[model samples]
Target: MPPGDAYDAVIVGGGHNGLVAAAYLARAGRSVLVLERRDQVGGAAVSSRPFPGVDVRLSRYSYLVSLLPPVIVRDLGLRLTLAKRAVSSYTPVVRAGRPTGLLVHRAEPERTRASFARLTGSDREYAAWRRFYGMTGRLARRVFPTLTEPLPTRAALRAEVADGAAWEALVERPLGEAIEAAFADDLVRGVVLTDALIGTFTHAHDPALRQNRCFLYHVIGGGTGDWDVPVGGMGALTDALALAARQAGAYLATGRTATAIATDGSSAEVTYRDAVGEHTAGARQVLVNASPDRLAELLGEPVPRPAAEGAQLKVNMVLRRLPRLRDPAADPREAFAGTFHVAEGYRELDLAHRQAAAGRCPKAPPSEIYCHSLTDPTILGSEAAGQGLHTLTLFGLHTPARLFAADHDAVKAELLSATLARLDAHLAEPIADCLAVDAEGRPCVEAKSPVDLERELWLPGGSIFHGDLVFPWAEEEPGESGPERWGVATGHPNVLLCGAGAVRGGGVSGVAGHNAAMAALGR
Candidate 1:
């Protein structure tokens, strides 16, 4: 390549990580070009009007983002408007007079625990809830960085060595066991454990699944780990990142899909096709924002060994009015801005998992519903415009795509109907009645199973974590390579692995992008 024409780096996929990597690299004085397959730059972190006047936040696969480090937010001066409203959750338990449900919100821990103690009458269990989340917050801060770097620095290494035992105890234990050790109430256990297994297919009894819970604990809300949305919607954060990336001197193209990555030892050649025609660029370094499996598909054959197995993700929604519970006395506030878990109890949740494993969507699926409109009213425009419709994101993981028939209409209706049925079980009326609208965001919701998310996101084996978050994978060395062992550095002269699909596993955190840029530019 001609010296004048060579770029220091070319980032593929204009997702947040790609934009972030471009910004960091350019800031470090590297000539950077960002190539996006889609016309829009946000990838999954985008908002588009699928229907007129219906602005849907197409958080495609991800809806929450507290895992994103504050450092990137500050360094890029990314101003984010988080939903100030607190998270509310309710689990219904019917009594003679009326149905009662446990409600938790922005309250003093003492008060929250007192409520729990009243319900379960276990002081020890209440204390455990407080301490567990407190520890989870601390642990997220400590472990989040591990997935970013190719290897830890001397300072980091020394710290890890010092805290080795504590780390093991925290990450290695089964999330269910960990919860059991901490809380006695089955209801409390069900709530806490449900989150641990949120985006994962793992049951509560599954080992290392608790680590997922630990990760989730940090992803939603901080402080005591409450879940919140951006003031306008989650898309606000992505918009800020894109604005920052453009300000830092990076080009963005939407709707242009990347076709192949040709690496010739020293540099990478990125080939993409858009409406115009095929275009290719040569860069000193290359970063991918796609899932590992998607990357492999784009590259075609001779696939790179995957870092993660990939995650199965599903979203169901269309809302006319907000879902009303069967119990009229239930707190309306708790029904909004918070997550609703239909798992009910451990046994039911476990059964749902079994059904999912059997290549069928569970009858009463274990769901985590997040009503975005209630929390961020700005998304719906002005109240004078009309009653803002609510959008609920239901995540189902571990189920393979085969559950749905290849027919698009059949599969969509099936999943949609099934999801509503589960909600109706608890609510007196069908949740679907509230629907002023509904839509499926899964790229191929009808034909493809949730497991197809692995291929769709282009990560290996559909492992969302890119691989297990176990020791070696979490603390990968610079030149290492193996199953569950991270080798974020491609060992090529300029290519750097920059997505959670690389080696750090998955999350909304931007460390993968930051570290990749640092490595490419020798920062």
Candidate 2:
């Protein structure tokens, strides 16, 4: 940890991606140094006890793991465990003052089909659902492996997809058009569309095709897109990565903020601030695991900012007991175990998007909730579990960045109230009633706005994806290298991106980190 120490490579952030890059490079016998600004290294992937004196540990920011390639897990020999949910999703539909809902059972397709029939009034919608996902499943298998290897050209990727109908439905047309055409019921259509809108603020019919990119990433993870909960929370995964990197001879230094990065053709210089003072480190190459906007600022360059506004509200709460659903036939445990959709029907989602786009909070906010303790109770220790405590994480959609720009506190409170009211509509009892109070007697409810995410996580515009998602394939330009190259390339020869801003980068996947290391190695 001495000043003027030269290394083979220097990583600017110690998030999962940066750690992954450092592990790979150092394992290959490169002297790598990872500089992390925060005291801890997991970035948004860490778990912590949010409520004071509460034994419950919640996955504070990024919750699930789906996009992480299995190859990286096997290659790194990580001991991370992910548990699958029994149910895929359940969407509540209120009719005639009664609770009727559609449940997509992961283990029991028959039950799911029955629920679909009861809610949509036919078996045809279930058949269509199978067909649509079947195509995506095939597309996922064909395309996901290519993500870690090299970027394929747009034409090459289309040839790999190899289905004209799928190409037209998923790639050519807006996602809304495809969903509407495929499903008969509005609720079913909305359920299908929710995957495309996660963290992305665009509508189903957005001409820019941002939703299409989002949908593609959501469905293609490990060729199945099953978002599984970490056994001991997300921190377990990153902690393992950090250990692997250190074991591979990577130097990990926390509380070091990278201030600037200057690169020439062959080498790079990184200026950073530690507790003591400013210092400089030299490396043959630099891997930046920060947002594109942050990187631009570090390099003292001006670039047009992408439309990367995050448009969701995250609320994490610990409940004393499970709330009862209005549906008499539905089991509350099964319904809450998976994704529970509230007021997220097609029309409701559309209206919320329109309202948020017009700078007003929707009257009826759309959201989805899931109980993590149902899948893995280990997060709630013996003490909390003995008290019948469970963790509920709610993600409210269409609560865009612009709404919180002027008055973040006011907008966050207003949005949380509206969103909770929307959830209460489907519950037999108010959600607030099933509360677990902290030592101070405050309700165990914490909400994070986009502004808060920006301030804490260094996410530009609070975007979880880093920027507007690009098409996962390569766009070949004149005088450029072959399409089969890593997407982590930067303007400088010795600098690359190892974060969410890289192409084919989003979610908790370490593909960007792996690709950045491979690019650095000239593989």
Candidate 3:
């Protein structure tokens, strides 16, 4: 905590990735110092009771854990539990003026197939779905383990996958073409494409293949692509990481905003500002856990223009009770347990994308809802649990940061209303009627747009992945393959990216953090 004190490594952010790096380095007996601007660590991965007087702790920003490597947990000895959700997803669609839905059961294949058959009127689409995902399952098993290790070349990874058709569909060609070729039903196609568009602003057929990269990260998590709910909320993982880092003799300084970082490739100095004044500390190496643009700013370099824009609306609500579904046969408990798709049909998603691209909110914005309390009631505590209160976190897609540029608050309010209205269509009762009131008698629902996230979390353009995702492996450069490649290295040898902006980074995964630690250790 003293000014001018030196350490083995000084991490410039206290996000989950920074904590991961700190834990690993400190456990290796290297002195580590983690500088955090916020009052605490964990960045977006933290639990909070946003609603006043609500005892329930919600995963405020990042909800689920998918890409966190098991080795990081086991090696750090983190005391965390990620409970799998029973239901995979329940997508409701009106068929022949009757309320119907397609439910993908997590453990029951027969039930999932039956739901698909009922929706599509045959087993053809389900079989195709199985074939497409089965390919990714193989890819996940092959490529996921390499994340924590040194980076591999594109050729090396492609050869590892060993499936030309699967590689071409996911890596070479546009993802939309593959989705069209595989699925017949528009609704079913949309469900598959949702994974490609989470927190990404792009069409399925994007020439840049941004969505393809997003899709790869989504399905390759934990080698199974299953997004599990953190048992005590998202904070549990970060809290354990912080504890491990501290136990290993890392110096964690909160409320310290990193102002500038000056590195001479081998040695570095991190200048940070606290309430008292500015202070500088020397380090053998400096790891940045903020956005890439933010790192550029601290190094007195020009920030990148056309920053990646986050394209999702986050809404958190405490409901007094679960709303009745339009479908009488479907249980509200089951439908709300997994991802509940709202206005996310394949064609509808494309339409929304086009509309948003033209500077207008889609008439029916695509969104998905997750009822976390249904799976983990411990977050509700004894009182909220007894009152039967539940939590619903809605993530609305295709409403980019541009829409809120002119009229930030107005657009946010308008989009929130439209999104909730779309969800209301599938419910027998209005969600408004089920909302829990805060202490001041106000509705407990709160919504955040891209602008809000940028302001609060310092996410450049509100892009959740910190920026556009990159392929996990190193692209084939003319003879550049070595152990020094962790995808976290910067222009300066001592500077490395440990945040979501790293090559193998995105989501709540600690892959980038682990890779940075390994690279720092020269392993």
Position 270, candidate 3: lDDT: 92
Model 3: residue 334 alpha-carbon error in angstroms: 0.5
**lDDT (tens digit, per residue) of candidate 1 on 1-523:** 2123357787878877887888887767677777776557765566644443455543555666655666787888888866644645666655455555556665445556665665675677667766776666655555555544455543464375455433444555566666677777666777776665654556777654534543443433332355557665556777888888778876666666778887776787888777878878887678777765566665664555533443344563546666667767565546656777665466667777788677666776666677777776566655412754666677654443445436634654676666657667777677656655423422212222344554454435555555554332433244433211334455454556677655443566676677667666654
Candidate 1 regions off by >4 Å?
1-5, 53-60, 94-98, 122-124, 144-150, 153-168, 207-226, 297-301, 304-313, 316-318, 383-385, 405-412, 437-487
Task: Flag regions of model 2 displaced more than 4 Å.
Answer: 2-4, 477-484
Clashes of each: 38, 0, 0
Model 3 lDDT, full chain set: 0.91
- Per-residue lDDT of model 3, residues 197-274, tens digit only: 999989999999998999999999988999999999998888998998999988889999999999887799999999
Best by lDDT: 3
Candidate 2 lDDT tens digits, 402-521:
999788898899999999988888889999999799988999999988888889888888888888888788767312431127888777778888999998888999999999999888
- List candidate 3 segments past 4 Å from native: 2-4, 477-484
Candidate 1: C-alpha RMSD to true structure equals: 4.6
Clashes of 3: 0
* TM-scores for candidates 1 onward, in order: 0.84, 0.98, 0.98
